[model samples]
Target: MFDFLRDPQWLWWLGAALALGAIEMLTLDFMFLMLAAGALVAMVAAALGLNLTGQFVLFCLSALVLLFFVRPVLRRRLEESTPLAVTNAAALTGRDALVAEPVTELAGTVKLHGEIWSARPQWDGETFAVGERVRIARIDGATARIERLPA
Candidate 1:
């Protein structure tokens, strides 16, 4: 294991790093890509005739720099709290839905996005008719709060 660490070939390390990065792309997770970058740095150091200890140190340093410093900045730039409604399940949050089942009182269920969701009228006085269009106010966890929408 340690003997292979002394080899001055970059192919193995580069391949491993690229493979990890590709996997990360599919998963959309950052950790694997960081590790892959660390491995790449180690690969380059090894190819430059650096000792095993030096290569390992380079790998650790690069990995920490990416994980601690780079990832947080990247996350701040790219983070999306509410992703676009690409799937039917996600579309229910803001779309108009009908009260399939009568929610006689303050609590009831509405059918939206081809699924039933627990709903409550936004205002205490507002009453929704069955089959009426109600705009989803917001989604909190499994519940979709709704309010009557004007025509």
Candidate 2:
């Protein structure tokens, strides 16, 4: 009754595309996005009566092409459009900190971004009184080297 029927990939291809797209969203990279595009291409091939082997071949070829060629262009464009954000310990540099204890050259504590941080003055005799606002000079290991802001 259905002699023309061949590959049944309606749900398979659609599911693969959705799954890859979701992963791409999490990773924010174009790798899985290219695979999703390939899945869509294979979905079209399947709808056109291509066999499973042909669908698979097209999917691989399309995915490789998109990954190597299209992905770079897309990723570069996106990076060019967005400004880079500082992160990690480097992000704490030059930020304000609230002294939670009397900070001396040796040791103390401060509230940095709602978290308590071990702090020290940059100079040998510099000291920060409790409730003083100091600037983070740099992060050394687990400690934040602080400096008094210019008067």
Candidate 3:
């Protein structure tokens, strides 16, 4: 059983590659996948009967090349294929809201996208009545800057 370990180093390398590949699936970063590729190269070196030092060198070179050259390309492609999603305050911009309380330039309240938020008028001396519709101008701290819709 243990006799195979003495002569067939490829088995160890192949096992390492498989383990790294498994870890890569959980991370999704592609770093461990590149290491698994290096381990596969080392397995090939072992099958070719290269000395331990030569196999290690080949593995190192393969890992470095893949990390520097292939990894960036793969990451960029992955980024490009994924859709950009807006959330939180960014998603609130340009949306309509209803005044929950009379809104003056200083402070008030509004129901924006189903949530009550602290709000202020967009311009000096501007005001909104309760039940009035307003457009969100921007967000500042915890407050939404709102402008009354044209009648």
Query: What are the per-model C-alpha RMSD values against the true structure?
Result: 6.1, 4.2, 3.4
Q: Which stretches of candidate 1 lie over 4 Å from their true place?
A: 1-8, 81-148
Q: Estimate the overall C-alpha local distance difference test score of candidate 3.
A: 0.92
Encode model 1's per-residue lDDT on 4-97: one tens digit a residue.
4556466677887999899999987688889899999999888877877887888899999999998887777667664555764456556888
Q: Judging by TM-score against the true structure, name the best candidate.
A: 3
**Candidate 3 C-alpha lDDT tens digits along 11-129:** 88999999999999999999999999999999988887898899999999999999999999999999999999988888888899999999987779999979999999989898899
Worst 10 residues of 2 by lDDT: 1-10
Residue lDDT tens for model 2, 14-38: 7899999999999999899999999
From the highest lDDT down, the ranking of the candidates is: 3, 2, 1
Q: If scored against the real structure, what TM-score would every candidate get? A: 0.56, 0.63, 0.81
Off by over 4 Å in 2: 1-12, 22-28, 50-53, 78-91, 98-102, 107-118, 129-131
Off by over 4 Å in 3: 1-7, 149-151
TM-score of 1: 0.56
Alpha carbon deviation, residue 8, candidate 3 (Å): 3.1
Between prediction 1 and prediction 2, which has the larger TM-score?
Answer: 2
The TM-score ranking, best first, is 3, 2, 1
